[model samples]
Target: MPRWKTNLIVLWFGQFMATSGMSMIIPFLPSYIQELGITDPDEVAIWTSIVFAGNFLTAFLFQPLWGKLGDRYGRKIMILRSGFGMSIVVALMGFATNTWQLLILRLLNGTISGYIPASTSLVSTNTPREHIGFAMGIMQSGAVAGTILGPFIGGLLANFVPFQTIFFITGGLLCIASLLVLFLVKEKFDKKKAAKTPNISVLQGFQDLRKVPQIPALFSVTFIIQFSLLSVMPLMAIFVQGMHGNSEWLAFYVGLVSSITGFSNMIASPLLGKLSDRIGSEKILFIALLGAALTSFPQAFVNNVWQLLILRFFMGIFIGGLLPSVNSLLRKFIPEGMESRAYGFNTSALALGNMLGPITGGFISGFITIPGLFIMSSVLLTFNMLWVQKTLITRKR
Candidate 1:
């Protein structure tokens, strides 16, 4: 097998383990906080938001720095750095006696986390340009598959074992992922050539990349894609409850509704990626955005769980198209040596969207209700589609 293919296969597992481990603990965070002795319902909610957002907050701030370092050193090294660092911090979360301690560890985990982005950068730089989209799509599939399974596995384990033990298991998975990358994935880095490149500040690098025009527009598309998709997530379970009525199976239904989207997304990613390789990523992105908006709009009017499930499934197919296309476009537009840094900025934009989406969704749902929030998400996606049409498609024409 080719070296790039080898890297892709190994890194796919690495991405899977990293993402699965992270997700394993996320669904149980509120219960863990309550285990730390915070009994008030409102206080539990407040701390959950704070602890959950903490990771993304620091990740947004520090992603560029890690990217800069990756460009200077090697992308493989950055992946190992993040993978191992997250392993230690997450394991230590099991030992925390209070929310403050847990929050601090979460912040540290965010500060050091960039394994997925680093892996993406490595694959993008190493894979043949023509195959970049397929590579990204495969990587995304691995991540989504992990996401789909993590909570189910975590839920099962939670029933049999303590939450703290799950954290330890999550850490072990991360460690195994880092070890796999260390032993299996290989990158050809020219130390002498990297040393000779001019050192620029992160801010300067951002400005220089923005000079390409498409970079910033692509970044905005990434932010909006994440923002629109995730804004509905916090309320999804509630929406299902309303439709299904009170029952013992509510949690199971909610989990099914959530994981179903990821299943379609995983299946669609590689197919759309190959299509993008043939038709051009710009075209794929526009159509995907339009499909996503169309699917989202109807979701507001769905009166039952099955209707909502079907819409979300279709939405996932389009959602799969968004990020891979964005990454492929970034590779086309970014300067040769700055791939890691450019991806870092894109990752930061993604993290910012992840951080804000739930907060904005929770706040907006209060005023407009969950169904109304779905309509708003559809509107935002429409605006994002038009932005792409005007900026990329029209200009290309």
Candidate 2:
């Protein structure tokens, strides 16, 4: 096998462990909040979004810094830094005695969270141009697979082990994932170029990227994709519990529903990615956005977990194509030598969406039902699709 292929497989496992470890604690976070003694329904909802959004809030500020550093030092080192730092920060969450402590730790976690993005940058830059789409699809599949199994394992383990122990286990897994990267992944950084590449401010980097025609539009798509997808995260578990209505296995059921989407996502991403490579990423992205909107609209009305699961699974099939397509397009447009910075800015856009999505979803839930956030997300995605179409037309002129 080629070195890039070897890197892809090793990084795939690393991505799996990192994503799974990060997401394992999410399914029962609201319950954990209650354990920390915030019992008000409204309070629980607010805290849920807060804690979920907290990491992205800080990540929004730091991703570009890491991206710049990656360009200078090495993307691999940045991935190692994030993996190890997040492991330590998350493990400490196990010891938090108050909501405030948890919230702060969550913020700190965001400050160090970039392994996935860094890994994506590495694979995108290192892989052969002809195979980039397929490789990205495969890479994304690893994350989807991790997402699929993490919640299932977490819910089951929560039944047998303490939440604190789960945090520790999550941390250990992250540490191991980072170690895999340190030992297995190889990058031949040009030390001469890296040393001579004068340091540019993040603002200057964004300005330089703006000189490119499609970059701003691509960045908008990144934000919208993350915003629409994550709008439901903080509410999914609570929504599942509502459907379940006083079950002992609520976490398991929640995990099942969450994992179902990822299962479908894992199946669909690679196929769509290869297809996009043949036809064009723009078409796949447009179709995916439309499909996601159609599927998400009905999720607002589901009366049972099965209905929700079915809709989400189909939604996943569409959403699965989105990021890979976006990444492919971004790589296609980014100037040579700026892949790390462009992706970093793109990551920042994603982080902004992550921060805003949950916070907005939480605020909306205060005014309407949790299911209502689904409708809002669908509507936003539809608007984004139209925006993309308009941008495509404008680009031709």
Candidate 3:
């Protein structure tokens, strides 16, 4: 097998393990906070919000640093750094005696985390240009699959084992992932060449990259895509309840509603990615944005959970096209040595979107109502589609 293909296969599993380990905490986070002796319902909720958002806050700040370092050194080493660092920090979270300790550990984990972005950089830089889209799509599917399964596995393990044990298991998984990459993934980095290249500050790197107009525009698209999709996530269970009424299986139905999109997205990612390679990521991105916007609009009017689920499934198909296309485009547009730095900034945009989406969703839902939030998401997606058309598609034409 080709070296790029070998890297892709290994990195896909590495991405899977990293994402699974990170998300596994979600299922038991609240319970773990309570275990730390925060008994007040309101206090638990407040602490939960703080601890959950802490990771993204630091991640947004730190991803670019790692990316810069990756460009200077090697992407593979950055992946190992993230995987191993996250392993230790997350394992320590299991031993925290208070919410403050847990919160600090979460922030530390975020500060060191860059496995996915680094893996993305490695794959994009190593893979043949023509195959970049497919590689990104496969990588995305791995992450999505991990996201879909993590909560389920975590919830199940919570029933049989102490929550602390789950953290240890997650840590082990992360460690194993790092080990796999260390042994299996091979990256070719020319230190002599990289040394000769002018070393620029991260801010300078950003300024330099912005000179290529498509870089910043693509970053905005990434921000908006994540923002539109995740904006509804925090309230999705409540939305399901509003549709289905109080039922014994509310949790089951909620899980179903949440995982269905990822299922379809995983199914569509590689297929859309392959298509993008043949045609162009720009066209795929435009069509996907339009489809996502159109699908999101009807979700506001859905009268039943089935209708909502069907709409969400279709939305996921379009969503599968969004980020992979963006990744492929970044590869095409970015300067040769700056791939890692550019992707880092893009990852930072992604983290910012992840951080803001739920907060905005929760706050806006009060004024607009739950159903209205769907409309808001739809409108945002529509605006993003127009932005892509004007900035990317029109410029290309």
Candidate 4:
């Protein structure tokens, strides 16, 4: 294989492994918390909800900083740091004796969470321009694949082994991922050019964001898209419980949903990304958002697990291109040097959504039916889709 090909594959693989490890915990976390002796469903719900928030809080705090740093220092270092740091944090979560400890580790993990940003930046920089949309879609699918597979693997492991064992497996993967990335992905620092340039800042990143009208639209859409989609993510285990099932299987079911989505996404993302490259991302955005909003309704009204699974698979098909669409759109408007920072800012928006999804989902699920959360998700996405189509994707732009 060619040297650059090796680096890209290694970079892509490293994230694929880390995300697979990290994502496993989500499906089974609520059950794990319940087993840890938190008897109250409401309290268990709150902690479970707060756990995702802990991760998002850190990502929110550091993403712009990391984005700026990636612009100045090169994205590879940030990727390396994220790979190594998350390895330790995730591994230690296995050893967490209490919910508080788990929360703290998760918070630290979020702060260090930029493996995707780093890899995306590298690939966006390195990949041939004509292939940006397709490559990013395939690369982004690594995350979706991990999310899909992690829960199932976690279900099996958590079934036989201790919950902490999941963390150990995740941590070990991350450690190996770090080694692979550091060795396989070379960072040729252009110190001479960097020295000639002014220092990059978060404010400058914002200015870059301001220059693109499409970016603000993309940023707003990114947040709302994730917010609407993930509203139910935290509550899936609880939903399984509502349907009369044990906690052990939550991972499997969640994995099932994720896997369905991931598989559908894997098939659809490249197609969608390619379509966007041929036509326009702005046009693709309206089509995808509407389909996703339409799909969220079935999850609200499903009668059985099979119904929910079918709806989720289709939903994944509809919305699978959302991530790549956002990236493709950003690439259309932003300059090359700014792709990573722009994507990082977008990821920060996703982190913001991640933070809100769990906190709000947990809080709402405590007060109302988990299914009700889907209603709000649908309503929000509908509003966002209508708003974006009317304001951003108009003929005047």
Candidate 4 residue-pair clash tally = 0
The true-structure Cα RMSD of candidate 4 reads 2.1
Q: Is candidate 1 or candidate 2 better by lDDT?
A: 2
Cand. 4 TM to true fold: 0.93
Quote the RMSD, in angstroms, for model 3: 2.4
Better-scoring candidate (lDDT), 1 or 4: 1
TM-scores for all candidates: the values are 0.93, 0.96, 0.92, 0.93
lDDT of 4 at 44: 80
TM-score of 2: 0.96
Relative to the unseen true structure, what is the Cα RMSD of model 1?
Answer: 2.1
Worst lDDT run of 10 residues, candidate 4, spans: 187-196
Per-residue lDDT tens digits of candidate 2, residues 140-243? 88876685668877887887898889989989888888888889899867867887877888888889989987888989998998898788877888888888
Report how far off residue 273 is in candidate 1 (Å).
0.6
Indicate which candidate wins on lDDT: 2
Model 2 misplaced stretches (Cα beyond 4 Å) = 144-149, 393-397
- Misplaced by over 4 Å in model 4 are 1-5, 187-189, 247-250, 395-397
Candidate 1 residue 147 Cα shift, in angstroms, is: 3.9
Q: In model 1, state the lDDT of residue 251.
A: 50
In terms of lDDT, model 3 sits at: 0.83
* Residue-by-residue lDDT tens digits, candidate 1, 178-255: 998999899988877888899999999999899999999999998998788777664565678789986755655666
**Per-model lDDT:** 0.83, 0.85, 0.83, 0.77
